[model samples]
Target: MSRLPDAPPPGAILEAAVYVSDLDAAEAFYGELLGLPRLMRVPGRHVFYRVGATILLVFDPEGTTVPTSDPAIPVPPHGARGEGHVCFAATDAEITAIRARLAAAGVEAEADFRWPNGARSLYVRDPSGNSVEFAERALWG
Candidate 1:
C-alpha cells in the first residue's frame, strides 16, 4: 500500500460543501436564517454563501449525479449515520444569541452540553438532516 504525505502546514478552512434537496430553500435558510451572505450563485445548480471567513457551498443532490463507488474511493448513501457533525465556534454570548436566532427562525435545537475541556456546545439539524453544532470555549484569552 502506498501512503500520501500529510496535509501541509495548517491554514484556514476555506469552504464546506453541503448537498441540499432544494437549492433555493437551502440558500434561503443559510442566507436568511443563519445570516450568511450569498457569495455566488451558479444558476440552478449551486449557491455559495460567505459564512464569517469560510464559504458554504450548497448543491442540489438530485441535479448532480455522484458515483456510488470506486476502487480507490468510498461513498456513503445520500444520508448516512456515523458521519461527523460540523461545528461552528463562537463565544458564549454568541452561542446564546444563535440559539435564540434559531428559535426565532422556527428551527429546533438540542440541549447544550459542557465538555470536560470546558467547552459548551449545542446541536441542530438542517433541512436536509445534516447535523450542525455550535460550540464555545469557557475561557478566552
Candidate 2:
C-alpha cells in the first residue's frame, strides 16, 4: 500500500458515484428533488451534479460496465450492482428543511435520530433505493 511513500493525502473528495437502475430516475431524485445543480448529462449513461465542491456521479449500471466508444477519454469500465449509500453534510436547520421538502414530495425519511455526540441524521431512499442521508456537520467532528 506504500506505492508512493511521499505522496500527500488528497485535499478533498472530488466526486462520489452510485450506480442506479435508470438515469432519469437518478435525475429526478438528485437533480429535481434534492435540488442539486446538474453539471452534465450523458444520456443512458450517467449524470453529474454539484454538491458544494464535490460532484455526485449518478451512473447507470447497464452502461458503466461497458467500454466507452470515445478514444480520447478511455475511462475504464466499472460499475456496481444493487443499492449504495451517500451522506451529505448539512446543518441542523438545513436537515429540518430537507425533511420538510421530502415530506412535501411524499418521500418519507426512513430514519431520523440523534447520535451520542448530539448530532442528528436523517435518512431516506431515492427512487433507485439508494440510502441518502443528511447529517449535521458535528456528526463527523
Candidate 3:
C-alpha cells in the first residue's frame, strides 16, 4: 500500500453529516429555519446545506443504507439509524437571534449552557432526534 505523505494534519473540515429519519422535516428545520443555504436535495434521500465551507448533509438512513448504483459504477451502502450530533459555530448575537427565531417558529430548545470558559451554547433536537448545538465561537476555537 502507498504511504500517505508525512505532513501536518488537514487544516479544515469539508463535510459532516447527521442521519435523519425524515428528510423533508430535516430540510425544513436545517434549511428553512436555520437559514443555512440549501446546496442540494435528493428527495426522500438526503439534503445538503452549506455551512461555511463545510457541506452539512442530512441523510435519510433508510435511503442510504442500500446500494443504489449500477454494477459498472459500484457504490457502497453505508448508513446508521440513530441520533448523531454536530455543533455549529455562532456568535453571541447570532445565538440570541437563533433563540428568538426558534421560539417564533415554536421549536423549544432542549438545553442552554454556559461553559467554564464563559462560552455559551444551546441545544435542540431535529425531527429525527439528532442533537444539534449552536455554540459561541470560542467554545471550539
Model 3: C-alpha RMSD to truth? Answer: 2.5
* Candidate 3 similarity to native, TM-score: 0.89
How would the candidate models be sorted by TM-score, starting from the highest? Answer: 2, 3, 1
lDDT leader:
2
Q: Is candidate 2 or candidate 3 better by lDDT?
A: 2
Q: Per-model C-alpha lDDT, please?
A: 0.73, 0.93, 0.88
Candidate that scores best on TM-score: 2
lDDT of 3 by residue, 1-141 (tens): 999889888999899999998887898899889989998888878899999979998888888877876799676887876789999998888888998999899889998888989999999888889999999989866
Which ten contiguous residues of candidate 2 have the minimum total lDDT? 1-10
Tens-place lDDT per residue, model 2, 79-136, is 9999999999999899999999999999999999999999999999998999999999
> Ranking under lDDT, best-scoring first?
2, 3, 1
Which model is ahead, 1 or 3, in terms of TM-score?
3
Candidate 1 TM-score versus the reference: 0.73
* Per-model C-alpha RMSD: 5.8, 1.6, 2.5
Better of 1 and 2 by TM-score: 2
